[model samples]
Target chain A: MLRPPYEIVLKPYGKALVELARERTDIICLSGDLTRQTETDLFRDALPDRFINVGMAEANMIGIAGGLARAGHTVFVNTFGVFCTRRCYDQVAMAIAYPNLDVKIVGFMPGLSSPGGPSHQAIDDVALMRALPNMTVVDLADAVEISQAVRAVVERRGPVYLRLKRGEIPVVSEASRRFSLHEAQVAKKGREACIVASGMMVPAALVAADVLDANGVSTCVINSPVIKPLDAATIVAAARGARAVVTAENHSVIGGLGSAVAEALAEAGVGVPLRRIGVADVFAESGSREYLFDRYNLGVQNIVDAAWITIAPTKPVPAAPAMPLTAGTYAPV
Target chain B: MQKRARLNGKSPGGCGDGRLRAGAPAPVRVGDLARLATRIRLHAVHMVGIQGFGYLGQALSAAEIFAALYGGGLMRPGWDRFCLSPAHYAVVHYAAAAEVGLLHPEALKSYGRDGTELEAISTERTPLLDLTCGSLAQVISGAIGFALASRYAKDDRRVFALLSDGEMEEGQTWEAAMFAAHHALDRLAVVIDANNSQVDGQVNSVTTLEPLADKWRAFGWRALEVDGHDADALVASMQSTASERKPLVVIGRTQILGGLKSVPATADGHFLKLDPALKAAVIAELEARLA
Candidate 1:
C-alpha cells in the first residue's frame, strides 16, 4: 500500500535490536564510535555487556567482529556507510567476508542522505559488497523494513551488509505488513511502466508512480530492499508486461540497484527499454537531502522523465514537476 | 639495526611463572626440542626442495620457535588457539605441525602443488591454525578477538599469534598493538620472528625498528627480547604471563638463514632459490643434523 503523509518512526532499528537481544544471549554489538548516529546507542545503553565501542578503528572493529563470530556469537557492527565499507574494505573482505562469518554490518546514512558530501557517502559500498563471495547485501526502505530486517538478517547464516538511513525513518508501508528477505514488496500495480526502487529512493518512486498513473500512464512500483540476492522473478514478471522499465536507487547507478536490475532483465531476456535513475557516476556535494536529490537527478521528476522517455522514445517528454518536500512529512508530492 | 644485548635483563630461570598444571606433564626436554627442531629443518628442506623453491629461509630461522611451541608443549593441543600472522611462515608451521602428529608427514610433499591445503602463503582454507594470515599485519587483530572471546566466555585458554619483523612497518600492527594493550588482554601473547630479513632487503635497511621492544612497552605491553633459536629462552619468556594483566610480546631475534653454510652469499634468503645440487647438499646436511 502506498501511504501519503508517511508518519515518522524514531529509533525503530535500535528498539527492535534491544528487544531481540533480550532473548538472544549470543547477540553481540560493536560500534566504530558512531553509536548514536548509527542507531546502536540504544543497544550500548541497554545491553552494556554485549556492546563494544571499538573507538573509530573500522579495521580493528571488523577483525574483532570476526573473532567474536568465530566464538559462536552473532555480531552487529555499526558505523557510517562510508567508514564501514570503503575505509576498511580489505579487513572486511579477508576477515569477515572470506570466512563467511555471522556479522551484520549496519551502515547508516546511505548515499546522499548525509550532509557530509562525497567523503561520507557510501556510493560504491553495494558494488564492493556484492563482488565478495558469500555476502548478503541489503538496503532497507523504511522504518518497518529496518525493524523487521534486524531479526531477519540475524537468522541468516553468513555475513550481511545492511544499509540504512539514520534519524526519524518514515513509515511507507502499512503497520501490519510483514517483511521477508526472499520477497520484493509490490507497492503499486499497473502495466505501462515498471519502477524498481531501493532505500531512500523508494518513496520518490512511489510518488512518481502515483503522478504517472494520474497522467494516464499505468505504472507498477516494486520496493526491493534486498539488493544482492534480488527478487528477480517478480521484477521480470512485471517488466515482461511493461513497455518500459526505470530503476531508482539512492546509490551510484554503476553497481547498485540499477545494475542489479539490468543484469536480472538481461538474464531473463526481457528486452524492455530501460532508464536508470541514480547518481550519474559523480561525487555529490554536501547539502540537505532535498537539494542533493534534485541536483543528482534522484527527485520524483527524474523518475517520471525516465519512465516517460523510455516508454515513448519518438516523442519529447515534458519535464515533470519537482517533488514537494513539506515539513514533518516524508516524500510528499 | 645493530645487535644489542637482551633488554629485559631477566635470566631464563628467573622469568616465567613455571607453574605446571595439576596432572599435566612438564614440557619436552631441551635435547628433545633440539631434535624436534632438527626434524623440522629436514622436513622444510625436503618440502621446499620438492616445490622447487619456497620460504625455506624463514622455516630455517624460526624452526626452534615452532618446535618449542608445537612439540615442546608451550602451546597446549586442542586448548590454546594459535594464529599464524605471517602467511609465509606456513612452511615452518606445516613442518612443525607434521612433526607433532597433527598432520600426516606425507602431506608435506604436496607443498605448493595445485589443490593442496599447504599453500606457500597461508589462507583461510589452511588447516591446523586457528586463523590464517592471508595479508600481513591483519591476523593479530583476529587473535585479539579470540583472546577477547576467551575472556568473555571465562575460559583461561590463551591465544598466541606469530608475526614477522617486516610486519612492524604496517600501521595496522600499531593499531592492533594499541587495542590489545588498552583492553589489557593478558591471556594474549605474540611471538615475533625478528629475523631481520624482508623481500625489499633487511628490515632496518628498508624501515628501521631498532627500538622495537621499547615501542611495545610504551604501548602498555610487557616486552621481552631473546635469542630466537634457543627453545629454552623462548619458552621461558613466553610463560611469564601468569601474574601480568597486560599483554606480552616476545621479540625472538633470529638470523635470516640460522647460519646455514651451504647456500652462497648470492642466494637471497628472502625468497630462497635452490638449484638441484644446492638442494641436495642442504637436505644431506639437515638429515645429518637429525641423525
Candidate 2:
C-alpha cells in the first residue's frame, strides 16, 4: 500500500492565512503566546500590526477577539485546544458565540497532538462548542485542509472553532478538491460498510478501510471535516447504502464526530447499526501521542473491530419518545 | 387614587399641570440630566416592581452615572453603533436606553416577562447590546478588545465599559486592566460603579480591594475617583480623558441602597424588599424634589 504524502505541513497554513490577511485588511490574528506551536508565528512575522499576543491570557484572548469582532474586524484567535475550549468557555459563549461574532477560534494541538498528557489533549472540545447555539466547529485532517478551512471561515462570517493538529499528518484531500464549511467529503467509495471520520482520525479510518478491504470487507471512508451542522444528507446516504456505520475521531465519543453522526442518523429516521471509536469519557494520563492513541483504542485496528461488530447487527428496539416540557417546567434562564 | 401626570415632550423643570413651561431649551442641560437620572430611577423602580423583585439596589445606585453619561452626549445612542457592558446594572441600562429612545419604552415594561429578551443579565443576543455581561468580569476584557480594534482601525471612537466594584475582584478584570494599561488603550474608558456593595456585603468586608486607585494606576491605568451619585463629578471625571497614556478608570463611589429608605445601605444588596408603600414614598420624595 502506498503511504500518503506529508510534505505539506502546518506552517504553510499559517503562511497562507497571513497571505490572505494581506489581501483582506479586516483579518486580525491573536495568539495566547502559542504562535510557534500553532504556526501562527508566520502570520505574526508577516503582519505585525494585525497580530496580538495576549501572553498566557486565554480568557482575555477570547474576550478580546469578541470585542474585535464587534468592531467589524474578522478576528482569528489561535491557542492550544485545551486552553481555547475548557479554559475560556465562558468568554467564547458570552462574548463570541452568543453574539454570533465573526471571530475564528483556531485550536492547535487538538486531541492528543501534544504528548504532554490530558492537560493538553482536546478530547471534549467538540462537545463544549456543540453546546453553544451559534458556533461552527471544524476539524482539519492535515495541513492542506487547514488552509482551506481557514480561508473558508474568513470568507464566511460567523463564530467558528477550528481544531488543528500541530504537526503535519497525511493529506487526505487533493489540492483540486474544494472544501466548504458544512459539506462532507467521501475519501473512498465502497459498498459493504462506511467509516465516518474527522480531524486526525480521517487518515486512520482510510487506512482501516484498506485493511478491511484486504479482509474481504469492502468499506467506504467519509471525511466529515465539518463536525457541526453534520452534513445530514451525505451522512444519511452513506448510512442508508452501507450495511453498517463506523464513526471515528480523535476527540471524545460523547460529543465529537461519532456522536454528531449518530445524532444525524437518528434525526433523519435512518436506522443503521453504528459503532463509535474514540476517546472514552476520561482524562488520559501522561504518555506519548502514539501510546495514548493505542491505550484509548483509537487506532486503525480499533476502527476495524468496531466496524466488524456494527455490520453484524441483529434487531432494532423502539423506545418511547420523551414528553415535551410544560411552560412552568422549562427554565433555561 | 390620584393619577400621576405624564411628562412626555415637556421641557425640563416643568409643573405637573402641563401648562407652565419652564422655558428650558430643547438642548440637554446638566440639571435636565439630573432630572433624567431621577426619571431613570423611577422607571427602574417600576420595572422591578412589575417583576416583584430584582437587582434593584445595584440598578438604582448606578442610575445617576448612566444619566450623566447619556445626558452628557458622551455616549452615542439612538445610532446602533456603540456597545454597552450591562453586567449587574442592566436594569438601569434598559431604563436609560428606553428613556433616550434607543429602545421602545414598551420594552421596558417587558422586563423579566416570559420569553422577553430583557433578561436579568445583559445578553449579546439582543440587537441593542453588543456583548452579554452576566458573568461579572467577562465584559471588561471584551471592551478592551473593542478598544484595541478601534485603535487598529484608527476609528477614533471610544469604547465605554461600566464595571461593578465587586467585579473588580474577578481575576479576568485585573487581566483586562493590565492589558488595557499595557496596550495604552486611550480610546477605552472604564467606569467602576464603586457602590461599595456586593451580593455578600461591603466590598471591603467581602473582598478588600483597598487602595483601588493605586491598584489601577499600578496596573498602568490613569485612575480617578468620584462621587457616583453626583452627576457633575461623574460627568467631569468622564469628560477628562488623559492624553498621555493608559486607559481611564473612573472609580465612582455610590451608596448601596440609593434613594430607598426601606432598603438599608449594606453589602447584601442583591435581594432587597421594597413594598408598594415604600416604593410610593421614594417616588413621591423624588417627584417633590424634582418638582
Candidate 3:
C-alpha cells in the first residue's frame, strides 16, 4: 500500500502529541484557551488530569508552565502565534527563558497560515524566539516532522519555542535522518545555487529546486529543522561551490531564517551574493495561506526567480575576512 | 520606564522622634529582630546619604517586614528562596543580607554605583539573591514558579515573594495570585508591603488597590493582615502553617516613612536628595534605636 505523497490531514500532529503525552505522564499540556485551534485539545482530552486551560492569558500560561516544568513536568505550551511571542514576551523571556527551564512553547499557525489577519498570525515568531537566549526554536517543514519534533524537544533540556503547522502538508524530506534538532539536511545537491529554507518554505524550496533542475541549472535545497543553533558547517559546505545563495521561509525576511542564513554565510566568509525570498517587511492582509504566499512572492515561482538571479553568470568576488573557517578558531569576518 | 511609577505617599507632617519613643518603645516583642530592623533602616539611610536619593521612604516602611522575613527563621540565606519584586528595594535586601551575614559587611558601600552588583533594584548578580526583578509585578509569577518547582522536587523548602502595594496594579499579579491558589501551592507565601506610597503620589490616588485582602481571599488564598512594622506580629503570622491545598499571603500594613526618626518634615523621602542635617539625624536616630 502506497501512502499518499501529500497528507492533508491535520490529525497526525495532534495524534502524535497525544501519544507522547500518554507515554510520559510528566508531559503536561497548557493551553491559553486555544486548545481547539492549536490542536492541543487532543492532549487535553487524553490526559485531562495533566492539562490546564489558562483562559486567554498568555503570560500567566507561560508562568504556570514554567512552574509546572520546574516541578519536574515536561510542559508543552500552546497558543496562537502572536499571543505567544508578543503578548507573552516578558513572561517567556523572564520566567521561562531566563531561568532556562524545561518548558516547550508550541506556537501554532506559523507565518501566514491563518485567515484571521495580522492579529491572529505570527509572522515574526521565529525572529522573536531566536533573539532570546536559551530558546531552541524549530518551525516544522512537513506533517511527518511533527512527531519527530515532539520527541526531539522532549528529549532536550531547556526551554524551546516550536512553530507548529496543522492541515495537510507534503513530506518534502522523506528520507531525512529522523529529524536531528541542530542538523541541516541536503535534500538535493547540484550546486548551481544553494536554497536554504526551514519550516513551510521547505516544500517551496524543493519545488523551486525542481524548477531550476529542469532548466539545466542545478540547485541545492537544504532543510534546516532547527533555526537556532543552526548547522553552520553544513550550511557553508552546502554553499561551497554554489554560485550564490538564496534563502526561503514562511516568515518575514527581516530577522527570520533568511537573516540567520545570511549571518552564517557572512561569518563563514562565503561572500556569496544572496537573495532572501520570503515575506517582505510588511503587514499581510487576511487571506488563505496560498493567497498570501503568492501575494508575498514566497511561492515556488519566487524561489525560482531568486535562484536565477543568484546563480546568473557574474564576476568572482573576494572571500570574506580570510580566516580558516574551522571549529577550533571561529574568528570574526 | 516602569521605574518611579509607584504612586508615592505625601511627606508626613510629623518626623517625630520615632527613636523607640523612650517609654513608648518600638515593637521589641520579636526578640533581636528589632535591632536587625534598625540596622537595616540605618544602612538604607547611609545608602540614601551616599546617593543623596533612593526609595528611602519605601525602605523605611518595609524594614520590619524584611526583618521578619530575612531576620526570622521563615527565610534564610541558602535554604529558602526570597523574591523581591520592583528591584528598587535592593538596599533593604542587602541590609537584611548583611545582618544575616550572607553578604560581606563592607560590600554595602557600592549601593548604586556603576560596575557594582549592588543595583538600585535587586538582580541575580547580587550574591545570595535568587530572583532578579526590576520590571514590576512579574516576580510574583516567577516566585510562583519557584514554589511550584520546590514542591515538584519534593524539597521541604518554601518560596516567599516580597511585593509592594503599587505592584498590585500589574495584572500578572492577580493572574499569578489565582494560579497559586488554583495549584494549591502551600509552600508559597506572598507578602505585600501596603505602604500606601508610590512615585506619583498616594497609591490610592494612582489606582485603587483597596479591598486588597478580600481580593486575595477571592482568589482562593489564605489571606492575613498584620502590622508591617510590628516584627512580632509579622513574624508570628508568617510562621503560621497552611495546608498543602492552599497558598498563604500576608498584607503588612505600614507607614511609608514611619521607621525613621527625622526628616525635612516636608520631604516625602520617596526619592529625594536628603538634607545633610536630616541625613545625620536619620543615622543618629537609628543608632540610638540599635543602642
* Model 2 Cα interface RMS deviation (Å): 12.5
Model 1: per-residue Cα lDDT at residue B167: 85
What's the best-to-worst order under lDDT?
1, 3, 2
DockQ scores for all predicted structures? 0.27, 0.28, 0.18
For each candidate in the order shown, give its overall lDDT on alpha carbons: 0.83, 0.74, 0.75
What is candidate 1's lDDT per residue for A103-195, written digit by digit as tens?
Answer: 889999888888999999888898888888889999975888888899999988789999998887898888787888889988899999999
| lDDT tens digits by residue: candidate 2, A99-212 | 677888988877765788878889899899988987899988565677677789887667889888776544556777778887798778888889998887876777788767
DockQ of 2: 0.28
- Report each candidate's C-alpha RMSD, comma-separated, in the order given: 6.8, 10.7, 10.8
- The candidate, 2 or 3, that scores higher on DockQ is 2
Worst 10 residues of 3 chain B by lDDT: B5-14
- Stretches off by above 4 angstroms in model 3 are A1-5, A8-26, A69-73, A310-333, B1-30, B76-80, B113-115, B150-157, B240-246, B265-270
How far off is residue B229 in model 3, in Å? 1.3
In CAPRI terms, model 2 is classed as: acceptable
Local accuracy of candidate 3 as per-residue lDDT tens digits, B1-291: 111111010111101112112232112133588778888888888876887888778678889898898767676434466677868788888777776666776878988889987777665455555564577888777677667655545566677888899979989888888888888888888888998888887899899888999999999999999989988788888889755568889999998886554765456646756777888888888888867
After TM-score superposition, the amount by which residue B211's alpha carbon in candidate 3 deviates from its true location, in angstroms, is 3.0
